[model samples]
Target: MINLFDTAKRILNPFFAKRHLLGDDNLFSINNILSKTAALAFIRAIDKGIKEKIEKLKDIDWTKDNTLPNFPKSFLDEYGLEDKPILLKKNIIEKNKLNHPDITEEEARRIIGNALYKPETILKANPNKPAYHNFISRTDDKHSDIVLLELSDEKENYEVINYHIINNPARDRKVNIHKKS
Candidate 1:
């Protein structure tokens, strides 16, 4: 019920939180930086008295203040944030499970075998490959760049979920299909 997003916006924006430490003028993609920047805001909220804004947001007697800007009505009242404290740590954990089922034990793997992030790696020596031919592509090649195939983690710590990949316009993307035996 606490406008985590508004909280995020507050924490992430230097102009909002009035902290230049969050500033990174060198970064051209402010939008991209904001997403990553918001994560820190989430952390900051927990460490400080963001409870007031979070509380006021969560309290938001929607039955009364049901107008303008995010007008919290249905969800806020339903979650009972108007009546209780909501710790995101507990909520995010449980919510993740309800979101999806993990890949089955037998079907899953503990460790990722040899993986290829061809873009991050050294270009293969093959002279005539298409990767070497394009002028625009050569300037910013992701072929050898590491594409997080399998992330290493501790023990059985895994979760089920869904994801979608949005390709970088600068990088070439293609699906590899294998033929049936």
Candidate 2:
């Protein structure tokens, strides 16, 4: 007689198995688009903008043609990513400061390049603290995804914190933090 458990798995196996039908390279490509380093860069740019009271993310001229931003030659050389088209946003948040007071472009890019890849979710958003920027990053799927909140001070920048991989980061993720663009 056929076992009941075996029969059920046989019927359900096709559905789950189909998910991995694509080759490994395809999966890698998808992940590359949301590279942890890219996310780190994205967060750093935002932090710099907010610290300098720029507030609006859209206003920053991060991309010329919705493509990569122009990076400094020193940054490119230090990272050994000269061939890579990806670069950090150029405009400084503050007109007075040529660069952000907190982190250098090189340090920011390196932080992105070195961040660990891990998926996370926004557990909380706090706008009450006028002196600090607070948010929590966590994932129900794994404990490894937990990350500390990003504070307003330069010392608590996301670059220094462990990077988080947010899968469905709808526009609402940072909605409360930034004013409407």
Candidate 3:
């Protein structure tokens, strides 16, 4: 078996040499090489952990808990709607779960609920579909969850048409800026 430590050293050696030669104080400081190397290793480890978690999620038997959860009364009250069953369909769950293997059913529910309660951004009367509104909420540093709600002709009924995770570099940059604050 290949030694990971040796492989990593081989890979990083060139990068370290280039950084040391370039001598860019802000971007790559030779004086901070040890710290930078440690930070990079930590980031890689976290990324690997996330990938393993996602793989575990993909293997889960979704059928074990196929029951659709109902939107809470508080969620209904926020939109000034009567307390009625507005459940997420199994097909939607299946589709989203397949699309975003990194997100669990409970995490998906929490993301949707959080978006409905306090969305970071809302695109009302979306150009593509005037009846559908997009609610975006940042889930983590790397992912943002979007919930699309379609208003019925009567304007009283709101149905969630779609929910999915998005990984946009620009969006992540904005999120990172906010996180810094």
lDDT winner: 3
Best-fitting candidate, scored by TM-score: 3
Ranking by lDDT: 3, 2, 1
Enumerate residue pairs that collide in model 1.
118-143, 118-144, 119-142, 119-143, 119-144, 119-145, 120-144, 120-145, 121-144
lDDT (tens digit, per residue) of candidate 2 on 52-95: 32222233343331122322333334323333332122332232
User: Each model's TM-score, in the order given?
Assistant: 0.17, 0.20, 0.43
Least accurate stretch of 10 residues (summed lDDT) in model 2?
A: 113-122
Off by over 4 Å in 1: 14-30, 36-48, 51-181
Compare candidates 1 and 2 on TM-score and give the better one: 2
What value does the lDDT take at residue 123 in candidate 3? 58
Quantify all predictions' global Cα lDDT against the true fold: 0.27, 0.33, 0.55
Span of 10 residues, lowest total lDDT, candidate 3: 65-74
Q: Give the TM-score of candidate 2.
A: 0.20
Go through the candidates in order and give the C-alpha RMSD of each one to the true structure. 19.5, 17.8, 15.4
Q: Which residue pairs collide, candidate 3?
A: none
Tens-place lDDT digits, model 3, residues 52-154:
4334433334454332333344334444456433434557667777777888767776666655544566655345566676667777777677777675565
